[model samples]
Target: MSELPMTVRVDGLPDRVTIYEVGPRDGLQNEKTVVPVEVKAEFVRRLVAAGLPVVEATSFVHPRWVPQLADAAELMTALGEEGRHLPVLVPNERGLDRALELGLEHVAIFGSATETFATKNLNRTFDEQFAMFEPTVARAREAGMDVRAYVSMCFGDPWEGAVPVDQVVTAGTRLLDLGAGQLSLGDTIGVATAGHVRALVAAFGDAGVGTDRLAMHFHDTYGQALANTFSALQAGITTFDASAGGLGGCPYAKSATGNLATEDLVWMLDGLGIEHGVDLGAVVATSTWMAGHLGRPSPSAVVRALAG
Candidate 1:
């Protein structure tokens, strides 16, 4: 295991990055086979041991919706007293209630920027979807929990091509208004280019959503996730969402692919001398172990190249 090179000064890029690890939740939820509660817990423990500051532990969505994460409660219980900032996905008030019962303190709410995706993913209109999460985020904040809102399909939608930048800003602003302190712009279909990434971040900033409150979550379907990440970094976004081993994709979006791999992201950050407090070797080991559990090779190019 080699050391990461010394941090370099990249103009406009943050000196430190907060990688919100989503492998245990978003990454595993998309898997066809149900991961055992024990494996999920161990996976999270490994990620934390590898120095991830924040990890999304699991989603509280109904079992029918994401059968893979059906043991959300049990899994959280198994991760008892880790003292990590484990943020779980709460689809609505019910999910939030369930999470609160376990003494969880952080949560993420999700909504879509495109009407087609909103309708298809949540079975609700754009307004209806926000209505669903608004109360959830409100109650969570009242309970003194930190909340993050994810705006999915921000760049492009499967049914609707090229989502307007204004639409994404509107969705993000609404979430910020709903008491979500952080908003993650998701390229759910992996259709965003570098130019699109910069423009969207700038639009949000113009709408008064500061880069400090924004995060980027990209898919590697067309292998643009890292490029989009760099674009966002230049745009002053310091937080990002990634999955270990590139383990997840949008089940709702047919053309969607695995997420930006944690190792891949770290590799680039290492070379650029940006300061993300993650061990590249440790993450590669974690992802490699997880891929074996999934019975497939890792989708991360960095992981493979490192193994060689």
Candidate 2:
């Protein structure tokens, strides 16, 4: 039997999609142990060499908040010249300054769609969170950098239960208004069904947030990430956030699990004949290598099958 999926062209889906790889940053933030900066650097290199178009390198968040990525500066140094092109997560103006000092051109900020999450993760009230992001986004744009906003917990929140579609759109559009070129709608708890996914995207569209400005970030907590991704694609979404070897989850949200695995997403995109510009065999090898260092089996079904 062949490892590739039979190509069956699907209508309404874009001819080519961009897979935003988050394994280095989002993937390792939750690790119980601090991954060496050298290993993190190599992980990013392997993924980039594997044909991933965009690899989010690391976050400049406080080391006390995410100790796994405490060596963000060192990791950037390890990446050297290439680091300037890769996007890094920066929590505030201070974080943005760190990225700027390193000559990075791309940065992303994390925002919450619900009050509870804002309080828990950001330690700010819902309204106050925007105030915190405004300056960071403004300065990043002023510095000629591309700003990507992540509206996390868009689908559901563990403390607040199911979130309203309108609420998420409001937060997302506001971030876009704040000079974010793109927004990644995050299903932090992975409780969203396909209908919920389509509805949320539609709500954003109704609010004048075009499909071009939106990307989907799904968790596999409820095993609904792939199905929800299909829903987003059916709704004309072309950008997806995935982690290689199924690494990543919300460090603040205990209910969250690994992100949609890049290998698995590639497998589906390949089967669907979507041009994501990723090499499945190369991705599997990279994830397999990273998994070896992590000392754990990959949660990705495709990696387990192909790398076994």
Candidate 3:
């Protein structure tokens, strides 16, 4: 592991970085077997107890598309009245309706930065997906609900490699203009390097998008998520999305793996003296519990080392 910079200036460090725990939704959604509703709720509860401000609880997409999240409505109902922001994925109008019916206050919409990914993931062209989100975004805003947009394959794509920087900026700008309160740039396949992270952040900045409205969602496919994250931090971003036990994978991209581990991120933040307000010990315990339940070792190196 790289040592924390000893003499780095503190002025460029963000005031704080908001870690959005996506274990319950994005993590569990990729599991081969159906995790019980109680298990899902317990996982979410543990994350909340660990002081996560935003927890993506579930996705309201059709069961045929993602059988893992077939119980989205049930999960939302089970996690009733949590004080923290719990957002669910809304793929389109039908998903949005289900989310609203459950009285959800926050929702997330997703689009891909690459044309091939957009077509494969959403079964539509990039323009089509954007147009589809138009009414849904407007409706969510009118209902006074917070909306977040995810631009997947922001760094690279599995089928279509090396996404252009200009393409990512355009997609991000469109989402922000469409009433997305925040935009999460997803390194969906974990193919991003520090150079890619720096370049993309620069692209967003040049396009007049503030770093405050952006978040980094990286997968550790090549063990580069943390390094890329540091590059993003230097580029003025403050929000990040992580998963417990590093549990998540891209359904559309088969080669992709879990996200950057929360434990690892917290450990890094602690070394840098960054304030995340998250309990690293508690996060490890939760990851351990979930890993045992799933019958697999944690993907987080920090968690494994700490356990030893």
Point to the candidate with the largest lDDT.
2
Quote the lDDT for 135 in model 1.
Answer: 86
Q: What residue pairs are clashing in model 1?
A: none
Note the Cα lDDT for every prediction shown: 0.89, 0.93, 0.88
**In candidate 2, what are the lDDT values of residues 1-308, reduced to their tens digit?**
58898999888888889999999999999988677888899999999998999999999999999999889998998899999999999999899999999999999999999999999889998889999999999999999999999999998999989898899998998899999999999999889899999999999889888899999999999999999999999999999999999998989999899999999999999989999889899999999988888889899999999888
If scored against the real structure, what TM-score would every candidate get? 0.96, 0.99, 0.95
Residue pairs whose backbone atoms clash in candidate 3: none
Off by over 4 Å in 1: 1-9
lDDT (C-alpha) at residue 119 in model 3: 91
Give, for candidate 3, the lowest lDDT window spanning 10 residues: 1-10
Provide the lDDT at 91 for model 2.
94
True-structure RMSD for candidate 3: 2.4
lDDT of each residue in 1-308, candidate 1, tens digit only: 56455656677677889898989988998899777788889999999999999989989899898899889889888888772258999988899989889999899998999899889888999888888888898899999999999999999998989999998999999989989999999999899999999999999889988899999999999989999999999988999999998989977888999999999899889877787788889999999988888898998988888865
What root-mean-square deviation over C-alphas does model 2 reach?
A: 0.7
Lowest summed-lDDT stretch of 10 residues in model 2? 31-40
Per-residue alpha-carbon lDDT of candidate 3 for residues 1-308, written as tens digits (9 for 90 to 100): 33222333355777679999989889988888688888898999999999888889999988998898998888878878872258988999999999888888999999999999989989989888889999999999998999999999998888889899999999999989999999999999999999889989888888989898999999999999999988888898999999988998988799899999988888877767678899877888899988888988898987898765
- Residue 8 lDDT in model 1? 62
Error of 2 at 69 (Å): 0.7
